[model samples]
Target: MDLREESLYLAPLYSRFPLTIVRGEGVYVFDERGNRYLDFASGIAVNSLGYAHPKIVDAVTSQVKKLTHISNLYYTEPQIELAKRLVRLSGLDKVFFCNSGTEAVEAGLKFSRRWGKERGKYRFISTVNSFHGRTMGSLSVTGQRKYQEPFEPLVDGVTFIEFNDGAALEEELKKGDYCAVILEPIQGEGGINPARREFIETARYLCDKYDALLLFDEVQAGIGRTGTMFAFQHFGVKPDMVALAKGLGGGLPIGATIINNRVAETLHYGDHASTFGGNPLVTAVANVVLEEVESLLPHIRKVGDFLGNLLRERIAPLDDVLEIRGIGLMYGIDVKSNARNICERCIKEGLLVITCGKNTVRIVPPLIIGEQEIKEGVYILEKVLKEGSG
Candidate 1:
């Protein structure tokens, strides 16, 4: 179908770019007309290893041939392996897999509620400007009111605390009425804001003091995007629960809520479940993706750091650029100019980037991207900025 026809048929939920990406490899994606563009957003940080990695393709093909899927009622080797690897890597005791970041978050929410009910507590505290997911339950705790305005009277007992504000967090926790406190170590959709070190440490301390579970939603910043397998590792502040997705499945769709032993055991048999949650096909591919990335984690960390530094050096000096805040591969450039216009200019210059928050341009290239691609994209961005300024 033609572009216009396709647009007419689809919902207007997303403001799509003018170009249609037909194919991708490494850090480059090609339009339908074969115009190659350097991919800096990595499909919003979903493609961890870039497009068409040989290992991923091979695993998916082999798994498809062996077993596509079966009921979760029975055991599946791939699911078992993926769960084991995740638990091992995360130092978490149990794992429950689902289809997307939102589902993973929903699962975490359920666990938190159950963790509270089993102990007789039932409120949750989330930070302002935090973005969890779009589902009703996850959306309730999401810090942004714009998303919740349409759907009023969301899950009750959700209090909003200021992000990176230790004093406010301390005040809220002192109330001693919250069952869980969930926040992203690095807020993704609310702009690339990193949690203050003191705030994170304080959150941990307060959660302990109040017997509330501290949940980290690392869906966008997890699975090697932040140099470490998980962002919480960098802070040395382990959360009671973590919601993971995005890069976890490479190109495939997968999500998981990892929990500590003591906390995880709160859920009973029928507390929560999903048919495709632990299916063999998705898990098979996720297992391969995890193993491949785990083996190349050191390389990912090195390249991510190099890219972040390059961005800081190149864009941080611009008069219109306000700040560069992020770690490893997930960095955002706070621009004084229109971030949407800059994103369009980047697309025109053969580099694909996206905007986040109000005035920040987010950069999240695939972990396998090399220094050459990084330099090339940055060069394009710099040229665009110079011309845009003029």
Candidate 2:
């Protein structure tokens, strides 16, 4: 069967680009027709190490030969090892693994509810423009009306405040009705806005005072994308819990909700479970991914600075550029025109980027992306922005 024709059988959930990527190799992907495109999108920030890293390839090959998968019913060495690594990296007590970022957010929400059950706190506070996940539980907390309006009467009691509004957060928390305050340290889909340090500090203090858990949804900004191992680290405040996915398993599928000892104690046996979560295959790959990311932190910082400088020097000066927002390898170019159109032009120019929010072009290159790739991607972006402005 022709792969292009077979794609029609799949659900039309995504407004996919008309590009058939057959394979990838180190910050670039090749189409079925052998056209190459520099990949700054990094599969929406999931490909931490870029495409076809030798170590990742070897790990997958070796693990597949030994064991591909087994249910969470029994002990698995890879799963246990990966949990340990995540716990260490996140500075959390325990971890609950799942299949994707949505699952991680779902689990974190449930854990928050469980923690507050005795206190009769079932409500949650989230911020505007934040995109949590598409799942019912995650969607309910997400503050975008366009996404939530269609799925009417969603899991209720989720209140939205302005992003980076400490006063608003405190006012709601002061009501003493919330189980948790969930936020993204750097809002990914909400135009790559980073939370203010004062804002997060306020949330931490208020959550402690109001007896609510502070949940940081680091799904899109974690795992070395922010130069730090986790985005929250940059703010100098630790969260009660963190939801991670995107870059955690490199290119593989995995998500983890990590909680501190206080939250972990609230969850008992059978309180939550996933049949395929923590399976050997993905966890094994995650272990390698984590180790590799840890080693690349310094490199990420270096290249992230380089990329940031390139953006400011090149793209920011363009007439259509509204603002440049982001940290580390994750940046967004807020333009005067449509972001999707800019991204399509970039794709045509043999560069791959994506959009966040309505007018922001999102650039989340691989952690392993280099100076040369940074220059190349920015060149395409600058060219596109200049043309659009003209």
Candidate 3:
């Protein structure tokens, strides 16, 4: 269907860009008019492998032909293997698979509540300006009131605290009513804010002291997007559970909540289930994504540094540039002006980008992205800012 026709039929939930992508390959996407643009956003960090890698294509196609899906009552090799790999990589004991990051967050919330049921502790603590998920349960814990106000009478019993405020966190956790403390290691939608080392350590310690679960929502920052395999690896602090999705299945719909033995043992049979949760097709693709990330992670670290350094060289001099903050491939340029304006201009200049936080343009390209693509993308961004600055 044509771009205009598709817009008419589809819901208006998204304020889509003027450009309409028809196909994607490598670090570039082609619009219906055959215009190619460097895709730095990577479908908002979903296509970490870039586009159509033969290995992923082959694995998914083969699995679809063999057995696309079977009920959870039966076993699938891909599902089991993928689960084992994630559990091993995460250092967690068990996993619950779902269809998206929001589902994963919901599952974690439920598990934490069940684990704390005996004490009647159902309160959750999340950081201010954090974006967990749009689902009812996940949204309740999300700190940003703008998204929650409209969806009010939410899950309830959620309290918001300042991000990186160790004192505030400790004060609340000490109250002894919190079942879990959830936060993103690197806040995605709240602007690329990374957690402080002290704050992370404090959360782990306090959770242990108060008998609360520390949950990391790695949906946007996991799967080797950070220099490490997971963002938490950088802090040397492990969480009781982690919510993962976006890059987990490499463009497929898959999410998982990896929990420790304590929480794992608490979750009995029938506590949670999903029809397409661990289906063969998606899990098979996730296995490939996991394998691809193993080799690509080092590349992401090197190239991510290259991208950040180049941005510092180019945009840091701009009058409107506020600051550049992030690590690995996840970076954001805090701007004095509107971030959407810069993103719109970048798209017209043959580059695609997105905005996060109040006024920052987010850059989370495919992990497979190389230095050349990053340079070209940044060059266009520089040109856009330079031209508009005067």
Candidate 4:
């Protein structure tokens, strides 16, 4: 099949760009025409270590030589190791592995429901403009009305409150009947907005007051993307559970939901399961990815801070730049004009970028991206913005 023709067979779920990327390495991707472009989006925050990292490649190769997969019916060493690493890194007590961010979210939702059932409450509270995933359970908790409107008659009892509004969050929690309150510490798809310290602290206290589980959806902001392993650490507030994915496997698909011991006990045998979840191949890759991330976290943070500051200093003063909001490497620039035009211009300038909600440009390069790449990418971005305005 002509690869470009494959688009016709696929569902119209994504609004794809014109270029077709065939391969990637480090912070760069090459299209079918062999044009190189600096990858600033990092596959929407999934390629944590960037493309074709040696460690990730070796880990997957070695695991394939040993055992590619065995269903969750049996024990797997890689899965156990990965789970342990995630639990230790996240400060959570246990983990449930899955194949994607949405699956991890689904697992988290089920765990939250179970926690509430044991305590006799079933309501889940989430924030406005928050995104969980497209799956039914996750979709139900997501706050955006647009995503939920087409798939109405969704799972009920989910209350949507305004984010960064401490009083509103507390008032909703005061109802005292919620099973859990799920939120994205940094809303990724909702325009890359970070949570306020007061809001996070209030949510923690309210969950404790009413015995509700605090779930942080760090799928896009976790695994070194935000200069911290998880966004919750930045707030200094510990959540009971965290839904993670995107960067966990360094490129290979993987996701996980980490839960504390008290809340984890709610999930028992036969309560939930995924056939490909915790397979040896994916877990082995994840183990290496986690190790690499832990070892290089210092560099990631340093580079992220440098780039974030540079972007702020350079773009904040621009006439067309509305605002730049983010922490570390995850940033969103709200432009005065349409983001699509700016993104297209950047592509023409040999840079890969993605647009987020409204007029925002999402800048989420791989954690392993270096300073020079950041400088060059920003230079291209500056040129695009300047020329696009002209």
- Which is better, 1 or 2, measured by lDDT? 2
Task: Report each candidate's C-alpha RMSD, comma-separated, in the order given.
Answer: 1.2, 1.3, 1.1, 1.3
Instruction: Count steric clashes of candidate 4.
Output: 0
Judge candidate 2 against the unseen true structure and give its global Cα lDDT, from 0 to 1. 0.92
Worst lDDT run of 10 residues, candidate 3, spans 1-10
In candidate 4, what residue range of length 10 has the lowest lDDT sum? 1-10
lDDT of 1: 0.88
Root-mean-square deviation of Cα positions for candidate 2 versus the true structure, in angstroms: 1.3
Which residue runs does candidate 3 get wrong by more than 4 Å? 1-7
Task: Please tell me which predicted candidate would have the highest lDDT against the true structure.
Answer: 2
Once all C-alphas are superposed, what RMSD does model 1 give against the true structure? 1.2
Candidate 4 residue spans exceeding 4 A from truth: 1-4
Clashes of each: 0, 0, 0, 0
Per-residue lDDT over 298-334 for candidate 1, one digit per residue giving the tens place of the 0 to 100 score: 8878888888888878878877788899888898888
Evaluate model 4: give its TM-score: 0.97
Off by over 4 Å in 2: 1-7
What is the per-residue lDDT of model 4 for residues 8-48, given as tens digits with 9 covering 90 to 100? 78876777777889999888999998899999999999888
* Deviation in Å, model 4, residue 30 alpha carbon: 0.9
